[model samples]
Target: MIGGKGEQKTLRLVARHADIWHSFVRPHELPHKLDVIERWAEREQRDTSGLVISNELGHRGEDHADDLYDAGVRLFTLAFHGPDWDYDLVRRWLRWRDAKNA
Candidate 1:
């Protein structure tokens, strides 16, 4: 659900063109949304198997970050909406990623 209220339109476009799908949702909500997306993908016989799921690291915090990661969300987005941004968590996450990949 990247675009407007047009769910079908968004899913359709994602089915064809999206390498990844980004959304702002709770960890508990991921499966249901993926189910909806899968249903929609099935309509067009579109496979979302190759699509990576992503989310923002807002109030989600560290625990939720781990939760989302376990739920298959590998890409986490952090907004730098400031004159001075904190790189601590980002660096730690990168290191974690490296260790995981290694």
Candidate 2:
């Protein structure tokens, strides 16, 4: 389940009830967020191994990819957004992601 701002409380509540803890967070702030999650787990004495942390990365750049990976982001959803909604743009991103993974 994806959660937004002011959603952390709901996220924590849902995290306990659900299988995933999905949210949008900047790469630079990920470590601190993860630390917060770790602390929350420690306090709740909850085994957080089953919880998944997912992030939305609009474009996959080397530095961003590395930062996200280092921050324990396992799932990434790339987006294509603008004044014009174009499938071609999304296709291009998929191609890029595929080549990078390759």
> Given candidate 1, what's the lDDT at residue 58?
70
**Candidate 1 local lDDT, 48-90, one digit each (tens):** 8988888888745567888888888888777765567777767
Which candidate wins on TM-score?
A: 1
TM-score of 2: 0.62
- Residue-pair clash count for candidate 2: 0
Model 2, poorest ten-residue lDDT window? Answer: 2-11
State the displacement of the C-alpha of residue 49, model 2, in Å, after optimal TM-score superposition. 2.2
Listed per candidate, the RMSD to the true structure in angstroms reads 2.7, 3.5
Per-model C-alpha lDDT, please? Answer: 0.72, 0.65
Report the number of clashing residue pairs per model: 0, 0
